[model samples]
Target: MMNHMKGPKGYETEGPRLIFEKKLTKTNIRPDQSRLLMPFKSLIRNDFLRPGIGAILVDQRNVKVGLMLTRWDMKKNSGGGTLNYALTCGSNDIVKGNRLKKDDDISFWSFRCHNVICFALVLPP
Candidate 1:
């Protein structure tokens, strides 16, 4: 009896091609993390959320979605004064599958300094 899936998928034993993304927020000068949020939001908005940078996604929990490389969001600071920020990166780059609610635990990692990083929920929307 065979027990393997088909069509370009990596098993957990093969390790994770995905990792956590990092935060790209500056200090004392921003309304929100637009660039990072945009791609992250876009990933959530659409179902293109995957676990790798290239086209092929993996099948592992440790994998991540993607990161924002450009400032695609339309957010600007007119005065540059202390802007309104609302980003909460809970916990380190650790996703405990059962210890806590998936939404509450946010993970992030920097792949050779890509500005920002973050992780996605185990479940899809």
Candidate 2:
């Protein structure tokens, strides 16, 4: 029996059993498991990011920078999820997220909660 440990995202057990999965690559990660083809980088809890919340990535001092959605790890305290910097579009290259802060304009949407709202930001042209 393989040992299981608390991991980011979900359960961090052995990459499932061979009987359960076929064609193993990269340790135990299967091609069918996730849609993320690129390598993922681990993220940690910060002043703005609460683990497991959908986050919008933007550059410092700019609001119009390309926005991408990312999530935190399932295990709040220990585990953190992944993101690919290559994906952040044209605003400015985020070297290290020098200025990541929570947008108070938005609030935390917890797990199993499907509350969503719409707002508009009209910038002067």
Candidate 3:
């Protein structure tokens, strides 16, 4: 006997595309060293957190590296009450993922010397 299974439909296929186009703006900052809290909050308030929106992180060269789907949590450390924000990186961008986590020190890459990057957070349709 033959069997059939359901699969993704129109919205599912087009969701990522739409989200990528509307949500976030491109930046010239490296993923490994930039402090994205302010920028992220601004993006969420202005773009993603609206009724239906999605966002993805891109590299300095406008190359999509990782995707930020949900806002998890933010904590304050005892040391000077520093704010630590936690985010989910859904993509396999080494710079945004493993590499960023490998070191504790914040190291920023220069845009002129490095690459100009940005993120696209698209609103759902």
Best by lDDT: 3
- lDDT (Cα, tens digit) per residue for candidate 2, span 32-122: 3221112233222122322223323222333323333334222335576444322223213332232212221211111111221111111
What are the runs in model 1 whose C-alpha is more than 4 Å off? Answer: 1-68, 72-78, 81-103, 112-125
State the C-alpha lDDT per candidate: 0.27, 0.24, 0.30
lDDT of 3: 0.30
Clashes of each: 8, 1, 11
For model 3, residues 15-118, the per-residue Cα lDDT tens digits are 11221112221221245433333333333233323211234353334454433434334445754333222224543353344333332323222111012222
TM-score to native of every candidate shown = 0.22, 0.19, 0.28
TM-score ranking from best candidate downward: 3, 1, 2
Best by TM-score: 3
Report the alpha-carbon TM-score of model 2 versus the true structure: 0.19
* Per-residue lDDT of 118 in model 2: 11
What's model 3's lDDT at 111? Answer: 13
- The residue ranges of model 3 lying beyond 4 angstroms of the native Cα positions read 1-54, 75-87, 90-125
Query: Which scores better on lDDT, 2 or 3?
Result: 3
